[model samples]
Target chain A: MCGIAGLFLKNRALEPELGAMTAAMLSVLTSRGPDSAGFAVYGQAMPGFLKISLRGAENFDFGAMAAALDVDVSVHDDHAVIAVPLEREARVRALLVQRFPEVAVVASGARMELFKGVGQPDEVSKRFGLVGMTGSHAIGHTRMATESAVTIAGAHPFSTGADQCLVHNGSLSNHNDIRRKLIKEGMRFETQNDTEVAAGFLSWQLREGAKLDEALGAALDTLDGFYTFVVGTETGFGVLRDPVACKPAVMAETDDYVAFGSEYRAMADLPGIADAHLFEPEPARVYFWERAA
Target chain B: MRVAAAPVAVNEPVVFDLAAAGLRALNAALAGLTATTNQTVWRVKNPRGEHAIAVGVTAPVCIFVDGPVGYYCAGMNDGADITIMGNAGPGVAENMMSGFVRVTGDASQAAGASAHGGLLVIEGNASARCGISMKGVDIVVKGFVGHMSAFMAQSGNLVVLGDAGEALGDSLYEARIFVRGRVASLGADCEERPMTDEAAAILAGLLRRADARAEVGDFKVYGSARKLYNFHVDHAGHY
Candidate 1:
C-alpha cells in the first residue's frame, strides 16, 4: 500500500507555510511508500489545462512533438514535463493522442505544479519544488510497487486529458475489464499500472457529464477491490474509499479546511488541528472538498 | 515463579502504586544488562487488557503477563522478551523493529501488522487479518488464523499450526505462509504452493523457536499465484 495526503483550504489561498506543512505531512509517511514520491499543488493562478508528466521509456522526443503543436515541453530523466498553452490545449492533447500513445501522462495542473521521482520523500521533494509551493490544496503519494513496476511513470496522481488527477493506494481487481471497456470507447492507455486505468475510467465518467462525486461513486460501484483514492481537480479535491473499507483513510475537517490521508501520522503535522478525531471512513463513502460555494 | 492471576486493580490508588512500583522494580532489575544476558523476570499479577504496560524495552526482560492485555501491550518492542500469560488485543507488537513477543493466549486482529523486524509467537488462535502487510516480521501462531491473514504481506514468515480462514495470503507477495490445517479458501491469485526444502526448514525452525510440538511436514504452504500482478483479460473473474 502507498501513502496519499492532501490539504484542501476553502475560500483562501493556502498559506506559504502549507509547503512546510505538506512536506512535514509527507515526511512522517515515508515508510508507508518508499519507492517514489510526488505532489500536485492547485492554486488560483494555476492554468486550466492538464499538466501531463511522463516518465520511463524515454524514446519519444517531447521537444519536437511540442514544437509541432507549438506546445512547451521540458524533459528530465525519462520525464516529459509538458505545459499546454491554454488556447491550444485541445490541439496539443490531440497531438499527444496522435503521437506517443503508449506513454502514461500521470497527473496534470494549470497553476498546479507536479513533480515525482524514484526515491525517498526528501529526494523527490528536493528534485521537484514540492516543499516550497503554496496552493488551495495539494496531494502527494509515496509508492511501494506491489503490482506495477517501480518507475517514475508508474507513480500516481494519474491524469487524463482534462484537468483531473488521482492518487490511489489499493488494487483495482477489475482493472482489466475496465481497461478493455475504456479502450473500446477510444480511450488510450500508457502504463501497465491498474491505477492509470482507474484514472482513465474516472476521467471518462467526468467527460460524460458526471459530477466529480458521481463519477467517483460510479467507480466505487463498478470497480471491485480494496481501494482508497484522493482526486484533485482544478477547483477542488475529493476522497473515496472502497466498500469493504479494507483500506485505511482518516479525515478531519474544520470550518476552514479538510485534511485526509491513509494514516493519522500524515495529518498529525497540520496546524490548528486541535482534538483531531480519527476514524475509518465507512464503506463506499465519497467525500468532496470544494470551495464550499 | 508462580504469579497469581487477578484482575487489574482499577480506580484504586494502592494498585496504581503497586503497578508503578513493580515497573520500577523491573527497571531496576534490568539495569546495566544486555538483551542476551538479563533474562529479567516480571510477575504481572493482574493484567486486565492494559495497553503498553511493558513496551520498548531493549533488555532481555522476561515479562510474564498473568492475564490478558489490551491494544499494543508490547508494541514497538525491541530486544526485550515478552511472554503474555493471557490473550492480547490488536497490534500486540505493531511495528516492532526487533526483539521477541510471545503471547501464550489468543491474539486479536493485526497481531503483528507492519512489524519491520522481530520474532512474534502467538500460541493461541489469531483473529482475522493477522500479520496484514508485515515487513520482515516473523510470526508463528500455534492455532488458527481468520480470513485475509497475511494480506499483501511484503516480507515475513507466518506459520499457522492449525486451520486457516478464507483468502489466506490474499495478494500476498514475498511473504511465506505455512499452515498445518485445512484452508477454507484462497483469496485473489493466492494458491497453495508445494513446500520446498527451504520452506520446510524455515517452518521447522519457527516451530522449534516457538517450542511448538507440531510437525513441520504436516503444514502446507500458501502464496500469491502472481496472476494479478499485471492486468489480464483471462483472469478477470478472480478480481
Candidate 2:
C-alpha cells in the first residue's frame, strides 16, 4: 500500500520546476503512504563532474566539509548535495568513508540526486526543499511500511546502480529467497525493504545487457508478487505491473511531458492535463518511453 | 389525491465537476434526488478515477461519466441509467438493486457482485470473480471473464459472448450461466445444462437489452448439479 509518482520534463522550460511539480504529485499521494517519503531528482550532468548526495546527523558541519574538500555542498536540513569533479569523487567518497563514517551516501548519479526522510510526505518534502529542486526527470515514493520497518533507510526510490532507481507499489512475496540469490551475486543491501530487492534485480538485469523493456518483462517471470513498478533510468522512466495487476497505476502523456501516478487525481492538476492522452496501463505489459541518446 | 410531482426536467445536463465539487458533494447530490421525481440527465466530469461515482441513485435518471472510475462506482444503484465511458476499477456496480449500468470499457474484479436486480453491459472484458455471489442482476459481458466468475451465484443471468475463465460457475446455486465461448474449467457442483428454446429466448432478450446481437444457439447453459446442497457421506471427500 505505497504510492509511486514520477514526472519527466520533455519540455526543457519545465526543468526548473521538476522538483516542485514532482513534490506536489507525491504530496497528493500522502494518504497512500504516510510513514515516510523519498525522491530522486535529476539535474543536468556536467561533463567530468559527479553529484553525490549524502545524509548526515543534525547540525553536521556540511559547510566546513565543503571548504575542506574544496567542493560545493548545499545543505538541505540533514542532507548535503555535493557536486564535485569526476576525478575527486572517489577521493571525497573515500574521505567521507574514513572521517565521516556516519554519513550515508544515498546515491550518486551523473544527473540525479536522491533525498529521503522518515516523516509525513509534505513535511519531508519541505524539509529537504524537494519542491525546489530541478531536473529533467524524477521519481518519488510515499511508503506505508508493509515490507519493512518505517526508517529512512527503508524509504524508496532505491538505487542499486548509478543513475538507475525504482519505486514499487506492491509487496514482493518472494523477496527473501531472491534477496539471498542477489546477495550471493555480490549486491550490497542496506535495508530489508522488498522494493530494494526489486531495484537490485533490475540493476543485475541491466548489467547483464537487458534493455529496459526486456528487464521489466523478465520481471514478470522472475518476481513473484503483486507489483506496479515505476523505474527511472538516465534517459527516461518506465512502468510495469504484475499480470494480475492488483496494484493501481495510471499514466498520462501530454505534448510537454509524461506523468505517472497510482490514481488519476494525482495528475488531474498538471499543466495541459486536460488535453493529455490518459489511460490505465495494461497488465503484464511494459509501457516505456525513452529519449534517444 | 397524492400525485407525485414530475422530476426536474432540465433540458441541458446538470454537470458535476468532481475536480471542483469533490466526490462527497457529488454523491450527496445524487442520493438526495427526489425518489418520486426522477431527474432526466446528469453529467459527471473530471471523475479522474475517483471511487464510488454516482452511487446509490434510486431515482430514474441518466448519468454520463466522462472518465475512468475507481472501486464501487455506481454501487447499489437503483433505477438510474448510469453509463461510464471509460474503464472501471474493482467492484463497479457491485450490489446494485435495480437500474442499468453500462461500462464502455473493461471492468475489474467482481463486476455486478451480489447485485439483486438490473442490467449490466460490459463492452469489454471483466476481470476475476465477476458476478460473484450475485442475486438477481442480469449481467452481459461482450468479452472474456476471468477466473471464478459466477461463484456461489444465488440467482441471476450471466451472459458472456466471449470465453469464460477457469472455474466458471463454481459452487453455483439456482443461478444460470450462459457461455458462448469455451469454459476453461468448471467448479464443483456445476455442470453443463442442455440449452432449451425457453432458455434461448431469455438469453436473446438479455442480449438485446445489452445492445448485442448473438444467436441463442451460440450459448450453452451451466447450473448447479443439485448434489452439494445435500451432504452424502460417500461424497464427503469431494465436498
Candidate 3:
C-alpha cells in the first residue's frame, strides 16, 4: 500500500499555494506510506529554458558543476535546480553524463522540478521547504516499499520523461514481464521500481504522440494490477485506476482546483473542499484535467 | 443546509467531531444511546474517510455524517437511519440487518452486500459489485452501478435507475434485480425475465421506501433461472 496525491489549480490565483497545499495533502497520507516520500512541482515556464532538478551523491559539487555547464543554478540541501537553454539541454545532459556520473538527474522541463528522499514525508518536505515553494500544479507520493526495497532510488514520483512523472499506490504484479519488454524497446531502468516501468511506458507513449488521456486509457488495458496512478505532465495531469479498482482513489474538484488523494482525509484540508464535488475514480477510466491554453 | 438530519426530536442532537474526539469516542457515544428509543439524533463532523462509522448499530437512532468515509461505513447496522452527505468507500452498509443508510453522493464497491434487512439508497453512482451476495435487504441506486453487481445474490431486491456495468448479477439467485437503464450483460445462471404485476408492486414499494420517484414501468427485471438451484446429474455442466 502507498499514497498518491495531486493538485491542479483551476484558478491561477491559487498557484502560489500549490506546494503548501500539496504538502498538506501528502502529509495526511504519511500514515498510508511511511517508508519514503517525494514530490514534483510545476512552476511557471521561462521561454527557451528548461529547469533540471538533480540530486547527487555525498560530496558532489553542484555549484562547480553548474558553473561548468554554464547555467544558473539554485542549490537546496542536497538537490539543485539548473536552468539551461532548451536547445542545449541535450548537450547539458551529455556533459553531465561525461563529468557527473555520480549525479542523478531526476526531472528536467521548463516548468517542473522534482525532489525525493528516503525518510518520513514531513521531514522530507521540511528538508526541501516544500511548504513554501509555489507552483501551478504538483503531485506527491508516500511509498510503503511493498514492491521494492526501501531506497531513495525506489521512492515514488519516478520521472522517466521530460517534465513527466508518476506516483503509484498499488503493486504491479506484471511489472517484471512488462519491464523486460520495455527494456528491450530501449527504455533504461533506473531502479527495480515497478512505478518506473509505468512511467517509462507512459513516456514512451507520449513520445509516440499519444495524448495524456489516450496514454492513460491505453494503460487501463495494458497494465494489470491493483493500482491507482496520478500522473503529472508539462501542461496537465491524469489519473487512472486498474480495471478492478482494488486500490483506493478519491478525487475532489471545485471551481478553483482539482485534487486527488488515496483517501478523503488527505484532501480534507484543501480550499473549498466542503463544497467540492467528490467521487472515487471509476475502474478502467482515465480522469484527465488540464489548463485551458 | 448541507447538514441537517432531524425529525422533530426533542433532544438537541449529540454532536461528535471525529477530528477532535476520535473514532472510539464517537462510536461509544452512539453505542451509549442504543438502549433508548427517544428519537435521538447524532451529528458527526469531519469524518475524514474513516471506516466503520456506525458499524454494528442495534438501536433506532439517526446519524448524519458531514464528510466522506472509508471502507465499511455503517456496516452491520440495525434500527438506525444513517445519512452521509459525502461519498462512501467500499462496503457501505454491508451485512446490514436493518436500517436506512442513505448516501447523498456516490458509493464505492459493494454498496449493500449481504444485507439481511434495511434500505440502502445511493443518490449517485455505485461502483463495482454493488449489492453483491445480498440476502434480504433492498438497495436503490439513483445512478449507474458498476460491473458484477449482485453477484451470487441469494435473496432481496437490487434496484438501479441508471446503467449497469458488465456481468451484472453474475451467479445470481433469488434476489430480484431491477435496472431502469441498460444492462451491460448478465452473469452466468442469470437471465432477464418479464416483470410481473407482483414484481412491479415490490419494485414500487421499495422505491417508495427509498424516496425515489422513477416509474417502475421503466425498469427491466432480471433474476436467476433456477437452473442451478437443484442438483441434477444431467445439469452438472451448468453448475
- The numbered model that scores best in DockQ is 3
Return the TM-score for each candidate structure.
Answer: 0.56, 0.86, 0.92
Q: Give the runs in model 1 whose Cα sits over 4 Å from its true position.
A: A11-13, A46-84, A91-106, A109-111, B1-239
Query: For residues B93-203, could you state the per-residue lDDT of candidate 2 as single tens digits?
Result: 999999999999888778999999999999998987889999999999999898789999999899999999888998999899999999989998899999877788889
- Which digits, one per residue and each the tens of the lDDT, describe model 3 over residues B115-210? 999999999999999999999999999999999999999999999999999999888889999999998888888999999999999999999988
How does model 3 score by TM-score? 0.92
Q: Where does model 3 exceed 4 Å of error?
A: A58-61, B1-10, B37-39, B227-239
Each prediction's RMSD over C-alphas, in Å, is: 13.5, 4.2, 3.5
> Clashes in each model (backbone N, CA, C under 3 Å)?
10, 0, 0
DockQ comparison, 1 vs 2, better candidate: 2
Local distance difference test scores for all models: 0.74, 0.87, 0.88
List the candidates ranked by DockQ, beginning with the highest: 3, 2, 1
lDDT of 2 by residue, A245-287 (tens): 7787777898789999887767867898767876667677898
In candidate 2, stretches whose alpha carbon ends up further than 4 angstroms from where it belongs are A9-17, A254-256, A271-277, B1-13, B38-40, B124-128, B143-154, B160-195, B213-239
lDDT of 3 at B169: 85
The candidate, 1 or 3, that scores higher on DockQ is 3
